[model samples]
Target: MTDVMRCEAVADIATPIGHAGRVSSPVAEFDPKRVRRLRRYTWWSVVPMASFYAILVITGLVNGFADGTYAAADLLVLGLVLLVLTVEATRFCASTMRGLGQGRHHGAEQAAAFIAALLTAGCVLATKPEYGFIWVLLPAILAASIVTNATVSLRWPLTFATCGSTAFVVATASWRYGPPMVPIRFALIAAAVVAFTIFVLVVAVWFWDVVLELDRARSVSAELAIAQERLRFAAELHDVQGHHLQAIALKGELAERLVGADDGAARAQAAEVAELARTALRDTREIVHGYRRSDLATELDNAREILEAAGIATTVSGHARSVAPPLQPLFGALVREGATNVLRHSRALHCEMSILTDEHGSEVVLRNDGVYASDGTSGSGIDGLRERFATLGGQVRAEHRDGWFELVGRAEEPGRSEA
Candidate 1:
């Protein structure tokens, strides 16, 4: 939001008197729709880990119930431990997915981990001797998941220590309380479960991180493009005005020196200075005019590049020259504004621009498939286009129909006689 506001403020300062009321720069607004879509993607990526964790919790509870050797007190203790692990796991996952700068709730996470570990020890002590290390699987898996959420510098070492300790505890408990043959096998199984759980949790966190990085990169790329455009305009203005201003300055000095000494020479130099000034003024106007005039073919090509960069497929049809020359600029503005809307306003997957012309009039239609909803308001850019087209006996309209958002503009052929 600060970046956008800064750009808008600069634009306001730079705008000419005639353009003061024009629509704001397309890049000046942040796209909440795109942000929300990315957020949804982030949440969905975390679902697999969450679902697997839930399934394991349920399985543990069911297994304890089926093992009838456990008394009511033991079962109650196991349930409470599972509940604490579940709450901690939830906190860890939330903190990891929210990314950096948001609070990680380290105190709560530490408390949960401590409580879970203590409860696991209780379960280990209370379970029947024959059951051995079976009750430890749930807490072991939960602990590994929580540990993997550690900062990058400590994640792997912490995970390894957690896994090794879990295995050793399970092995010792089995040897001390279970059938003699089960210790080594149960230890290996415990290690495998913890390793696999950590792997899944790690992959899910990595996926979420990648999505966030991509989003940040996209924003940086847009801001860079805006900066480059400003530089280009500045360079062109400097190029156009620099030579003329220099020559005018030299001529004015000559005219000043010649005065009272050579009246005729002074008048000639003054005329030259005036001519240079007029030429500079004219050239500056031309440069500004060319800058403001949008060309249909150039805009179409640009739109294709931008949409493709954003992962949206783009198709542009119909020749630029086929549109009446007078209407080309209008259609070009439509294309540019349409592209901006498609990107910022919708989760568009595909975009199509079609230019159509005949003896009667010219038309350009932009279509995109990601229309979620439309409240029938076309926004300031489209509203401005509508007013411009209306002055020329043409019309521009935005419509949402048949799962597509369409911006259509039509204008009569210039110089065509009325019947």
Candidate 2:
């Protein structure tokens, strides 16, 4: 019964780990939309607020020293400070929303920040009427926001729109208030267009890379969850079914012997069989309720039982230690699968199971003295096993050589535990 329980436990542990192996690539699980939204918020809030504060401070210093617009500068400073506070508030709110997985509201927050920055630029233009060239800052901020929010290909067009707008506004302001030189005006516009375009592209690419990284992290988290679930189900099935099946088999044998020989004995055997069946039914119900996994030690014990049941002389040797609780299922599944393959495919008389911790990871190996087909051909089962191991960042090797078939797997130490 203990042996049966062990087999079940091993089975339970391996399921989720095997499943995780199937969906292991971090890239595959990334959500592009989430990354894009985060980029949009970060760029819109950080860049504009920083740029506005820098320009406001510089303009205020010039007015205080050279011109008697200190009062005007003071008002501008207050307004700009308020705008900075608004930007910070929006950033804080957006981060909170993101933490709660509310990505949809990110764009709205970004737009709000943009509007605040634009308002600050408007106030500056009104206060320092002579420094109207600073109005060019608004279009530059819009262009930077666009590049940060959108993809690389759209950057050029967004930059051009910003530069063209800035140039038109600055040119009109100059023509109205002061003398404008065609050569110098064109040169200034051209320089702003070129410089802002490069700036937008560089910042966009940087933010886009950040988005990709976030996507990768999200993908890995999803894969981990999936692997855990698979391990859990595997453990439950192994525990419930393993004991039930053995009990049924034992009772069935006893019933066969007692049949027709003695009525009382036969009736007793029948009762035993009935009880075993009921127990199995109840266990099945419990399994169906939910799947929970056992630790690695439990799984190793289970593997030994499973191999022994197959008439394979099995031995397990290792210091009893705990693995990450979530990973226990994965390791257990690998052992179960290895044992199953030995029983089902290989005509093996002897099997050996060993676990050891190395510098890199914990290694589990199963070896059988069996006659397997010489050709390297994998059926559905082998393919599935391969996929399972791959997801766990482990490798599986099966070789049939010199009347011995061996299967080996490794699992790395997890940084944290999962409940």
Candidate 3:
């Protein structure tokens, strides 16, 4: 349960909200995407780990064969231990590829591997005194594998196992060979082997984490990109609909007021309202056709019109056409979002916009002092705009202060990092 929860938490951090639930589950059925991701992860993580364990098994067997000190029974015993280790090592690899103890237990499996390690170490100790060091190498490698593959925390147990195995190997070497010389030489050997094994295992774990984190980061980037596209589309849609809807509402009301005064004037006003509606429909189609990403110059004009209709005093300065070509989309979205926010949220009748460009880059500041209900920050639109400008080393900030709300965004000049 803890492992499951832990994996889920990591997935949540790495995956996007829309796909978090489906992708986070280790127990999830294999789809093409999941399989592809897992395969890539395993290629780098599990394959190298398996190679490390294989080396131990092969080296241990070679040591046993080359040293002709064992009887037939002893040889059989060594072979039996080697067999157990080989199976367990292979099992470790399989389990890793499948998922870290998805349907099985982690601690128990690590314990079992630890015991196999101890058994291998013991066999090496009993066989040949001259080859006592080989025993430490095989078991230490196995210990490293156990440490790397564990799902649950095994820091304390792994510490005990390493310490115990090192001690036992040293003691066995002392008892087999001479006194001071044997113990001193073997203790140093055991300590070296144990330290190297722990280092390999720890580094393996660290590299594994890096791989997972990279994978998670990739997924998040892809999802965030999709989200930004959707938001830009929605914000554009809102701007289209809002601009026309406000026009229709204002013109229809005007026609209503003028109907009793003059038939000709009322008819003309109604005709203009009809023309605006048709223009809105055409604009919506053009927007859908991807005719333009953002039109800052046009949006600024529409903003002033909309705000004035809403009885809000508006002061707009700075020419959008003067902004660098690359920055049109960013400032375009900004103006559209700024207009929507001012007309919808502010209860006061004052707004000020200033678009400035200089050495640093382009900047847009939209401020309004009114009955500030919310922070007046752009929702998904902000994220989309931020992403666009960030490519050019830009940033965005929103502030509500002193009975006033402010949104300030700036993008740096490309290739001017030295400045």
Q: Which candidate number would show the highest lDDT if scored against the true structure?
A: 1
Candidate 2 lDDT trough over 10 residues, lowest sum: 1-10
Task: Answer with 1 or 3, whichever has the higher lDDT.
Answer: 1
Candidate 3 lDDT, 1-419, residue by residue in tens: 00111223332323221111222322221122443454576556544554565565556556656776556686677667656665665565445443332313466766676666666666566556655455565466556556555545655576566756676656764665677776667766776776676565556445545545544543343334335445667877899899999999999999999998987899999999999999999988656533364455655654554444333557788877777776766676677667666755666457788889887688988888764655545577667667766777888877787877887889865667685
In Å, residue 186's CA in model 3 sits off its true spot by 1.8
The runs of at least 3 residues in candidate 3 whose Cα sits more than 4 Å from the true structure, single-residue gaps closed, are 1-68, 93-105, 150-157, 293-419
Candidate 3 Cα deviation (angstroms), residue 283? 0.8
Mark the regions of model 2 whose C-alpha exceeds 4 Å error after superposition. Answer: 1-61, 68-130, 146-158, 176-419
Q: In candidate 1, what are the lDDT values of residues 1-419, reduced to their tens digit? A: 01112322443223221121333333332343555566676656553354455566556556656877656776687667657665666556666676532326474555457446635743463455444344454555455555545667667776677677667766776575557667777767777777777776667667656556656555455444445545666777798799999999999999999999999999999999999999999978655533344567766766665555455667888888898777766777778678778867888877889988887888999999888676756698888789878877899989887889899999997668474
Between candidates 2 and 3, the lDDT winner? 3
Q: Would you give me the overall lDDT of model 3?
A: 0.60
Instruction: Tell me the TM-score of each prediction against the true structure.
Output: 0.72, 0.40, 0.52
- Pitting candidate 2 against candidate 3, the one with the higher TM-score is 3
Model 1 residue 190 distance off true place after TM-score fit, in angstroms: 2.0
